[model samples]
Target: MVTDKDGYIHLVQYLTEHLGIFENSQQQSVTEDTVMELFEEQLAAQIIMVCGQNPSLTFSQRNLVVREVDSIVYDLEEILARVSGHKATAEQSVFISELSCLIKNLFDQEIARMISL
Candidate 1:
């Protein structure tokens, strides 16, 4: 679970340091829109962190990462589907799509390696 832990730490650090991306212009305000955006950004950060630590991960550990990514994808898809029916913006869709692709690619590569081995 080192990969997962590292991912979480990195995500938390990113969110804390990059408040502008996560918080509203009012500085203390956090609307539903901002919260959703921050969640997506955190997921992306976690995916990147896990991918970067993949080389150190065992097969079982890699599988765990795959499961984690799959869960995130499912959650993201549900949220996106709900939001799309509303008034979701192009930027939000693009960000989610890009992050989803990154997570999928990393998970696929690791899973393929495990199967080949």
Candidate 2:
């Protein structure tokens, strides 16, 4: 289920949702740390590393992407805290603000059609 992972970040599509429901029931399911490690190894660095590389979202994939991004936005603060040792700083504050803006624009406000990867 989704590359042998236990948890699932919600996607608008049925594939991700069903995988989550099923894999989560397995005794050998993956853990949160595994997902985090995978993200850190793959997509985590890309968030800032990519920077403003927005492109048009395809109609078929938009919903799935939206759900995944929405989950990221929801959990970003906890992720940041883990990375920053829970120490608040002006830079961190500003970054959080920007992340909030991105979440709002992408999901809540629904402004941007393009997502940078």
Candidate 3:
């Protein structure tokens, strides 16, 4: 249960981190802000649902989850830095597209893991 919760938390952290990267990379536009806000809300709901189900997890377990989240945050920061630009190169665009797909896969896997738990 603890592991399941940890995975979900980590998944959300990854999503938000990427969203932040996207936010920072994009111009200060209303569309970007709206999309980022929506993404944040979606992640927040997932975190709440996962934690609510496994309320008995230990403090250490929770901390472990947070640590994983932090790690992904750092990773996303790097990925964002690489991809952010008004005119991304072909390689940069491919990297961003691949990263986006991988993040989506991770979210799907985490949701399945939570359900199985």
Which candidate wins on TM-score?
3
What is candidate 3's lDDT per residue for 9-105, written digit by digit as tens?
6645665565544545344333332332333344345455555656765577556555544564455445444433334433333335454445444
lDDT of 1 at 105: 55
lDDT of 2 by residue, 1-117 (tens): 121123232221333233332223233323333333433333433433323333444555455554555466345434433442223333333334443343333342232323333
Position 39, candidate 2: lDDT: 34
Ranking by TM-score: 3, 1, 2
User: Among all windows of ten consecutive residues in candidate 1, which has the lowest summed lDDT?
Assistant: 22-31
Per-residue lDDT of model 1, residues 1-117, tens digit only: 322445444543443453333222334332344445545555667666655755666667756775675566455455444332233344444444454455545455655676467
Instruction: Give candidate 3 misplaced runs (Cα > 4 Å).
Output: 1-28, 31-45, 82-117
- Which prediction has more favorable lDDT, 1 or 2? 1
Per-candidate Cα RMSD to the true structure, in Å, reads 9.2, 14.2, 8.8
Can you give the lDDT of residue 116 in candidate 2? 32
Superposed model 2: Cα runs more than 4 Å off:
1-70, 73-85, 109-117
